[model samples]
Target chain A: MTAHAPERPAAGGSAPTAPAPGRAPRRRRSGAGGAALTVLTWAIGLAFVSPALWLLLTAFKQENQAATDPPTLLFQPTLDRFSAVLGADFLPYLGNSLTATVASTVLVLLLGLPAAYALSVEPVKRTQDVLFFFISTKMLPVVAVVVPIYVAAAELSVLDNVWTLVVLYTAMNLPIAVWMLRSFFLEVPVAIVEAARVEGAGLPRILWSVMLPIMAPGIAATALICMIFSWNEFFFAVNLTASQAATVPVFLTGFITSEGLFVAQLSAAAVMASLPIVVVGWIAQRQLVRGLSMGAVK
Target chain B: MSAATAPARRTAAEPGGGPAGRRGARAAERADGWRRRAPLLPALVFTLAVTQLPFLATVVYSLRSWNLLRPDSQAWVGLANYAAVLTDSQFLGAALNTIAVTASCVVASMLLGIGLALLLDRRFAGRGVVRTLIITPFLILPVATALLWKHIMLEPVFGLVNFVLSPFGAGDVDWASQYPVLSVVVALVWQWTPFMMLLVLAGLQSQGGDVLEAGQVDGASRWQMFVWITLPHLRRYIELGVLLGSIYVVNTFDTIYMLTQGGPGTASSNLPFYIYQRTFLGFDIGQSAAMGVVVVAGTIIVATLALRLIFRTFMSAQEAK
Candidate 1:
């Protein structure tokens, strides 16, 4: 396992060291075969991504053009549907999504960072048990508890409130954040921490001034992963929220019954709803693997 | 943070060396322990409050004969709901569907992910662009992905799937309705394959070149190297991918909801969706709660195995450094 460590850098750093010599020699050995493989890879990539690309294209097409048999590839693009979707009651749901995602991420960071710090830097007793407990909650299917959550929320009069979503989302993402952040915290050298302690730096000061700057990228990566999951979460949003605090996912539920009608409009709405996370995910692609793997890989 | 004051308090209380000093020292040590634990309490408490309390309520709800529509029909029916859930054919069917969906989705996506990871393992023109393209499906909102497949790709007359297959003499097929489970699986595979690919790609990239180069120096064929060396090296990664992927995919709801609604009559419904239907649509709170308990019990069996694998992977990685 230690042998694999040197090849795995921190997230968002760069490609692994193996790619340099590992591929160059192979390509040199079989140039034609490699070229054919590249082409095949490109073809498969295009085909695999075609659905998403088609969604984008349909978003820019007229309703009639969007659902053509041959799929109108060269139609005049338009933003009518985009404007139309936005002109509808889309902003409120978008706002709710933003509130839930941003607030929950912040909450997770606040709560998880300290917990991760305890688990890693200070070395809490039975740290493994605590960590296991956190992650095991993740294994508890949301469906199992949604009924009680709904009933409880109703009793508390917070059923359709954005804060309810915020709290739930925080719980949902906290385990991942704690695990990911703890891995990052572990990467902070023990020598540096010991030096800080020698200098009479308190735990809060050391965390705020010294370690935060070093693991900033990792924290951002963790936050991005949290945002992705929170934004994409549908079950809780759909079941819990109503007109007042429905998130973007709940907004999309309106399309479920629309069925064959408004293909272009549905595409437009889907594009807008998914665009933020899609771009963030693309930019943070390297970190995404580490986050999704709970930092087990890198 | 609170550890700063512990030494001060200790010295102020205990002077020299005796039983009293020992007691003071023990008190200070306990305080230090509490300080270490303080940072963890908020998250632990919040997780417990938000997650565990409801689950406990669900247990309580399971034992009661409660229906939302019947305001006066609430009473204790200990284990009756569980009996009904175990015997209900729909619940059994849904449990089976959940297994099938989770198993097939994880296995298929993992296979595709490995293949894609291998393809992208090498240097190539526009590799970054290609990787981004492959990953876009996963980035798309799951709801949107479901809608895209349902409306834009799987709709019979004008859908792109049949149109693309038309050249091969395939006729129009209403995919979501005709083959609900397959349709859901196709969309899930598209979305999840990228995730598996990324994990496998990480694994491939982490392979030490020295070992592979050693294999090459020994005149090992590429296929021989992949089978003998790369595949074995990828075992842990593949296991991690399958476990993590099943964890997420088993809770699939948005895809089934937006694409098939677990239909043509619960054919594609997994446990989550079925439990949701019983609770919300059927308004059978007690029965759904029972089903939820059953699902959790089943998940515990699988998750215990999964947790062991995950812990092994994580611990080994930690020990690696």
Candidate 2:
């Protein structure tokens, strides 16, 4: 096996000594040692990826093949499961999910962006206290809030309501959004804010014209993280909604009713329900760790 | 006229002496503060309304025996419900299960994550792709992970688990029925390991080149450099992983709900799942509310410690700068 480049050793290491013109770069490990590392890495990498790969394979298998006495590496693949879910009210659930995710994401960003600005840029006297408050809200497990909310919703006659989900989802995501957006906003150059101020722009104007453009990428990153989180949220979606307002996560539970029997169809629906966030997450994975870690790792 | 002129001129010449100008400045400062706060208040108020109000309600409800099922018997019970939950055998079992599951997942995921991160940090080919693949599990929806694990990965007849075991001549085992909490922990660890890996990977990459080179120049072996430098640097990352992992793991309702449904006599039910079962299924609203308070208390304890550690990490980082 040939050795391939791993990490760019550009980080936290001495630059390789300049290579003699006619000689191969000495930094390139080109012997049995390199080959062994390459094989080992592939083995580990493949092992890590096995579950997802198996999920995908199962998604494409026929029902009979899926629960066959021994799992088969090769089978006559079928799209029946995918086609079945397409017609199985997947779209409406998809719609509910999209509406809840998009609406709640917008709500979070609109509210969270300003709060983040205040916290990161022109912080108040009790900035840390305020941030801790936001984080602490998140730490309160949903179990604590769900019963009360359920009771309240029942009284308000809003049980199984999508609008309620939108509101609840917004609340669910707001704290993390504020924390993440604040961290992202802090990355904006103070010099730029000063330059705008020197040009006679006031606070609101500085935020609109100067900060937005400079921090557009950061905002996009924050928004993306928020969307992935809101999209993948399950507990609130399951607990709060009934048929009319059921989100994709709840929709997937229908498969569980049939239990282990619909292995193929279940895998297909699982893939579909997970695809949006999985793709979103993959696209935003770099910002994701930082965001989920509440910007601490960064 | 000259005396009046002298007073006015002195006030003007002092730059900020006039009460009117000082008042104007004060008003402007106040406006600035409001402007800064204007953007923040909407979110803070919204979040507080949601948490504080409902939390107040949760607290109030916990103090009463306000069960919808027994609506006619509604009465202020004053710690009776909490007393019930505290002494309930189910709550005790679930609490123990929570600790077992959370501790195992956090420790397993962090250790595995550290190993993968150290490996991926090396300068080799295909590391980027591998890193992405490693993150695949974390990216998948929690419910999907549970379903996939229960139906596909752990299915008795054909699950990947049994298939892998069969080569060693072991036949199918009803993993969930038999192992219960261990089965759930396995799935949780799979999903969470990537998150820990991401944290540790960030730590590994953040190491300063100069220090690494200096160590290498001093003929530091890989294990020595790792133990003396990398491990110490990753201390907070590991801690962050554990704390965050614990927060999420303690709330491990999704998997246990979908996978085992807290089955085999409530063997695998964590606290959140137990509370969920009580409130939604058993209709024991008062008991559930009491248990919810307990979960919140545990969460607060964990969150406070985590927040303090995270605060220190950032403080130490800024000090380093």
Candidate 3:
């Protein structure tokens, strides 16, 4: 399933068209040009990332220095803003966010793993139809159901509940998790499963002892992707939760009304809210492309 | 196979034979099918309950007049809300804005993404670091990204945009307030370009080196090779990127809410934000529900066509492998 495997050229294909002897001088001539292009690539990359870098810098600045004419570049960096954000009751929102994100991701894996296995490895009838059904749910706009969700939540008296978010986020991410996990399941060879079956290992035993060890990294990648989305999700969080169960994004909304008044404090809060997922995403950069495409590209 | 045969053999040995044995075997097979499907049931049932039920409720709600602010206003309206939604100037405006935002963001980000992917495809020093830097914006919280633009980067008096443009005599211009749609689009494009780039980069890396080398030997120019080979191979990846990107971007609310609040008079309100305003702010449940249904209807029409195209591409890709 890895797209990185290059196709083998035919036996006579490369032999007749071989230009290997000319390659050395061509490579030498292009060395300076390559270096120049690398520098340009580096510059563009930095420029593309500058806004996030600016946010990092602003988080360390004082209130006045954070938003100054000519955008204060040199300044005495301080930790006051972070302290201010923490002191201002930021922990509850952080706890709620962690609870929703972690709980939902775990739930998604629990439910999605078996479904993916059924669809890929053992494949009950109409496997493609089942896969399409899952992906179609993702295409259904969240706004279409928010009104009912809100009404139902109020009626059920769970409007500001963290568990409500956990459930909704599970549904939100389950489709992608299933698709991605299915792709991972497909990559596992049939021979291994047959070997386990031949050993008289039951379904549960085979999954626990043989399959999970191989699928651990894929599952971790799926979990990371789910956490990233659940952490950053604002639509449902803002509309559904109030003070009691408001997640990090909902806490950020508190700054929206106040706007330019809390520039440094806002940056500090944003940094804290985004840091965990950003670090996780950076660590799983290679898996991200696969996860984002629902493993279609890979 | 053994279980089916054993049952048949015993039944044949008994007096009441063929029909009874076939029926028993069919029943056993049905049970076996269900057993195989047991693992899929929990997810399927959960998804149906959580996702589909609310949608069903939305359709029912759209048919009735219910306003949270106006207690006792709940009554069967029979498509009045839908009619109102179709005629409402604000709804129409938001629909247009949604199209503008989704289209421009996807197109702009994809073009920029192709360029960035091409640059990263080549052997370069510190390429890993450069790729990491490029993808960081996407990893940041959307709310944070919106705030960064709204306050630090686009603020008139102390904005980074103005400061960088000061040498060109550009004054403190209120970019968010004056050009709300463009500001929102810029924020969204920044967040999405990395996604497009990653997909395109995967496509680029998956290319067979032998083919490109063959092209070089055949005296094909770089541009010719890219056009004839690279672009054709990348079509499916690009399609996937655009489809997925549009689906997410069309539901954009955080950027609108944090940056402009769809302000300067609803100039930047996409469908999701507009529906939020109607439901939460206006407390017009029936109207918003109707709008939601309309949005879904439009999405279904577009998605069905797009999904068919992508599904074929995906299946063909799978078969090719």
Candidate 4:
């Protein structure tokens, strides 16, 4: 979570430390060019982030204040909107979201880990066919499956249950998890495994005592991504659950009605609903970056 | 070197060093197979129970008329439901709308993300904080994000955007009513551009300096370098970005549904929202199921082709290496 300054080696112990001897002045010129580059980068980043900043600012204002003709930025801040959020079932919705996200993330990791290990280490017969089989499941539109899933849930009377969400979310996250963890597992050097086997460790022991530790960061990354996916998921949580098991996204909908919407209250709720994910992203942004950028790019 | 001879001496003592040793190796191979397979059971069961069975059941239900109000009356209707879905104007319109919305979002996000990535790729003050802020939209819950856009930000008169623009003589725009499709496209792009930006940035960062320097030394201008070197390297990442973005955008319900509920008279409604409205709101399960199957089939075809296209370069590059 700590933001550290990026350190480039000033003079390295390895490789040619300096650019070719006569190129110092050219490097100095490029260093000045880099200063100009920095300004351009900040401008671009700010533009990308403007919309979200607008949303955050809107959440802070009063209903009337937000819509003022000149839109006063220096108005005294109010906690009244935040108070309304607290007055509502904000804690309950937060709890529901936490339960759903944690349960789903745990299920995805537990299920995906072994499957990825199997596929990576053993190289099953017809492996490409099996890999395709799992990946292809994502092609099915949720709309197509929702009716049957809804009916089945109605039959089993688990429609509004958090556990039902856990089940669905586990399935939703497994394919990506398997793909991610398989790559991570593959990166473990074969020499280490051969050494472990020669030392008389059984397969299960080798996995638990060796592979699991090496892949811990991968597991964490996958788990964080899975948690975000589950936490932010709306369609399933909306269509499948009602009051009893409704997650925060559904709870946010309470502010919206046919008659009228309370903008401040809704904004407050939206902020609250988004708070956990924002916190998570803040804490684990590094992991999220690595996890999402798994594929070797350029 | 002397220790290596100890293994040979031990093998000589055992004297089972030919056919018997081969049989033992075969036995070990069989045992290894079971050992390797042992960890795979839970994942297979979980996937099958949660994903595979539900999907299979959806297919079955699509072919059957199972309105649980009369459990005993349910029976297979085959293509009748599919025929009904095809004939329904609402479903067809919704399908078109879905395609249009997804395509618009994919284009908008890709362009915006590429532009943003290009900008953010250089060194800058406050770059780290700026990067985090830019991705805040992606981290927000979808439903909450939609509500904020539709209500607080896009709410014609009281919305902050209009409030900010009013000083420059810009009046409030009825985002949902007058420009329904465009509104949804903007909202979708806002939510998803970070995804594209992150992937493209990853691609950009991986392009080592030597290649760009080589292009520079060859007397290439910055524009030419970007076109000839950078853009080509970004193809795979961009394709993956578009594919993943489309998959979500096509099925997106929360933002559009929350923002417009498929209105100012079905203007913003896409296939997923249409399917939900029919199945739940209109109580037309059979037709909705049929519509869903079509969506599934379409998605599968497009995804498969996109994956194949994106991987071709990667595959050939590997082979060449």
Tell me, by lDDT, which candidate is best: 1
lDDT of 1 by residue, A1-298 (tens): 1222233443322453334543323334267887898889999999899889889999999888987767789989999999999999899999999999999999999999999998887756678888899989989999999999999889999988999999999999999999999999988877797789789998888889989888888898899999999999999999988889999998988888754559999999999999999989888888888899998886
Clashes of each: 0, 7, 0, 0
Q: Chain A alone, TM-score for each of the models? A: 0.92, 0.86, 0.89, 0.83
- TM-scores for all candidates? 0.94, 0.91, 0.92, 0.88
lDDT of 2 by residue, A157-272 (tens): 99888888888889988888887777667767667876887799987798789887766656666677777777778887888788898888888788665554588898899999
True lDDT of residue A293, candidate 1 = 94
| Candidate 2 residue-wise lDDT at B40 | 87
Name the weakest run of 10 consecutive residues (lDDT summed) in model 4 chain B: B1-10
Task: Provide the lDDT at B133 for model 1.
Answer: 88
What's model 3's overall lDDT?
0.86
* Candidate lDDT (C-alpha), each: 0.88, 0.79, 0.86, 0.73
Q: What tens-digit string does per-residue lDDT give for candidate 2 at B1-321?
A: 112232343345344648897997667666766766788899988888877888778888888776677778778899999889988998999999999998999999999999888777665667667777889898888889998888888877778888888989977798989998888999999999999998898787777656766777899997898899879988988887888787778777888888999988899988888888888888777778888888788777767777898677754653453
User: Regarding lDDT, does 1 or 4 come out ahead?
Assistant: 1
Give one digit per residue, the lDDT tens place, for model 3 in B1-321. Answer: 112333344345444449987787667767756765888889999999999999999999999999999989899989999999999999999999999999999999999999999888765557777888999999999998998998888888888988999999988899999999999999999999999999998888777777788888999998999999999989989999999999899899999999999988888888899999999999999999999999999999999998898677666665565
| lDDT score for candidate 2 against the true structure | 0.79
Q: Compared with the true structure, what per-residue lDDT tens digits does model 1 show for residues B99-118?
A: 89889999999999999999
Q: fnat, candidate 1?
A: 0.72
Per-residue alpha-carbon lDDT of candidate 4 for residues A1-298, written as tens digits (9 for 90 to 100): 4221112121111112233232221222256677777766677677666756666666677876665555556666677888878887677767788899999888888778777777766544444455566666666778877887888899899988988898889988887787678766766776787689779987678878989888776777788888888998889898888888988888877755533536656766777788778887776655565455332221
Per-prediction fnat values?
Answer: 0.72, 0.68, 0.67, 0.59
